[model samples]
Target: MDDVTRQKILDQIPVIDYIPKENSQAFLYLKRVLHWQQTNSKNAVLVVDDSSAARSHISALLKRRNFTVVTANNGVIALEKLKEHKNIKMVITDLEMPEMNGITLTNEIRKKYTREQLAIIGISGATSGIHSARFIKNGADDFLRKPFCPEEFYCRITQNIESLNNIAKIQHAANTDYLTDLSNRRAFIHNANHRIAEYVKRKVSYCLAVLDVDYFKKVNDNYGHDAGDQILKVLALYMRKHFGGD
Candidate 1:
């Protein structure tokens, strides 16, 4: 290349500047946000694989992503771990294992915990599609073929956890009052109807009562919306303490 062309090309290259310590408020804020993301990525994960090397590798990867990891060598031990760690939100299990394989574990888990509460991902080295199909049909939320890339593994784990969190948030909003953090009218109606149906089916006696705050409108008018809200919250708390049940 000619000297003049080389000089022109070098001049056209963009120069990057590092942020100064005194003027790095935005950079600091970005760092905080990333830290928060890493901290809240996963609650806990159970890794079930017969191979010690594979379990170690998976646990290391999850720990790097700021996840609490517990491991089990077989499905039976995985169930025990699940019982011991009630906060485990996700499970990664190998399809082929000794003493209760992945499919049986998934089925047993589903009997107690729904997809909204727990996320299950099955991994297998077998190329047969039947294994994957069987896993999903038996209540596995996702399936991964073994020897997968680390990126794909983490991606699937993140997606499943996010999905479960979204479902929980939706259910909470549906069943809870926004202001008082108590059960809403819809929840009350649903539960009351269920109890009524069960009682009627069994020919049992039950009592129903309705209570309301007297002069609620006067309180709102005389005090203020804030005072009225406080009164409602107190009333809700009293009800919860005295009359709450399934």
Candidate 2:
């Protein structure tokens, strides 16, 4: 960040302290606001290691900071945990462990996980030779050496989690239709059977309409593309607003 941006953030921390301790209401209000950010982040960091002690240590550190943590002893267990809890947005693995060492774990994950799937960080005692580079080549988003500083570890973890979230959002937008903000026809049908089961089980009514846009061809010919685009946006917004916003 530039000097100005850094200075602005530095300024805000001191200002937050200026609020009087006597004002209990203001303190409660601000505290809730800060907690809401943590809640909505919904970030989960999975600490995978053969050692239970290592897993518990990392889990405790993150939990104290308000992030959710999951632990697994081996690669097989890790993948099962991932499937059981789809919101595990990040994974931190220790290399040179038992069955399903870091490389094997990463390879399995990369097979099913796109760039949007999950952010994986590899931590190892062995940093020399190809050990560190192998982790990166096998889809590790970041690498950390053993005996790292607390602050540096926190920074790298935060960066990887944030990066994964942003990439997932972009991929979602690209695959979805902008006008309706829903999956396009092809995307919708990619797993239509799965999506439709809920509606069928609930016995809910749905309507499929063949919309013609009320002479869209003529509208485009008369008003040009910009106006036509605006019409689509307006209609989509109206549909979403009244129809539970998808």
Candidate 3:
């Protein structure tokens, strides 16, 4: 193909325009918003479809929006890709495929991955609402019908990803100490309850110890809060290094 023909075909591809060179105020504002989304998003998405053309189209759309995209021809292939790519946080899957259908795949994935670890969106050309409902019943986080508008597709993806990130943030805050980055009291209690049940059931011998720093308040009052924090951090690090578990 000639250069002009190639350029024309490239322009025909469905891609979002995120650049901010336009002069209009509204366009500039949109550009800024898109920039923020791009910078904040670092998620990898797995796209599973039996149709190569469909895979390419959706992958291009996701890439234009600053997401990392990996394509698999079917759910079996998608599962392998998931094992290989640990960074993948979301999956966009088609319901109809050979070897493994989307519903079956979604069910299998849910057995291993929780909603917090991986988000799944089901897409289908089926016009029936039953298809979307079944996808949700099979563990998909969201569903989109085929022939969807680009705007709607992006909105669904953004909403699901943002929800996952927010959940992770909340879980982190609940489980971790704000100052020491160690497991907080809540996490310790939760874990201890589980361990206690396991030990009682198995009759395993185990021991727990609680440590308190001597004159910690004096250290804070004399050396300052920063020094007290450093001392606590050092103790936590030493404990982690010496008593870490698998």
- Which candidate has the top score in lDDT? 3
Candidate 2 colliding pairs: none
After superposition, the stretches of candidate 1 with alpha carbons farther than 4 Å from their true spots are 1-42, 188-215, 224-226, 234-246
TM-score for every candidate vs. truth? 0.71, 0.63, 0.73
lDDT string, candidate 1, 183-203, tens digits? 789998998899899999999
RMSD of each: 9.6, 9.5, 5.6
Candidate 2 residue-wise lDDT at 122: 88
For residues 132-225, could you state the per-residue lDDT of candidate 3 as single tens digits?
8899999999999998866578778878887888899999998999877889988999999999999999999999988999999999999999
Per-residue lDDT, model 3, residue 10, is: 45
Q: Supply candidate 2's per-residue lDDT for 211.
A: 62
lDDT of 2: 0.75
> Any idea what lDDT model 3 has?
0.85
Regions of model 3 farther than 4 Å from truth? 1-41, 189-215, 224-227, 233-246
Pairs of residues clashing in candidate 1: none
lDDT of 2 by residue, 122-185 (tens): 8887748677789889988888887664446766866676677678788778668976576677
lDDT-better candidate, 2 vs 3? 3
Candidate 3: the clashing residue pairs are none
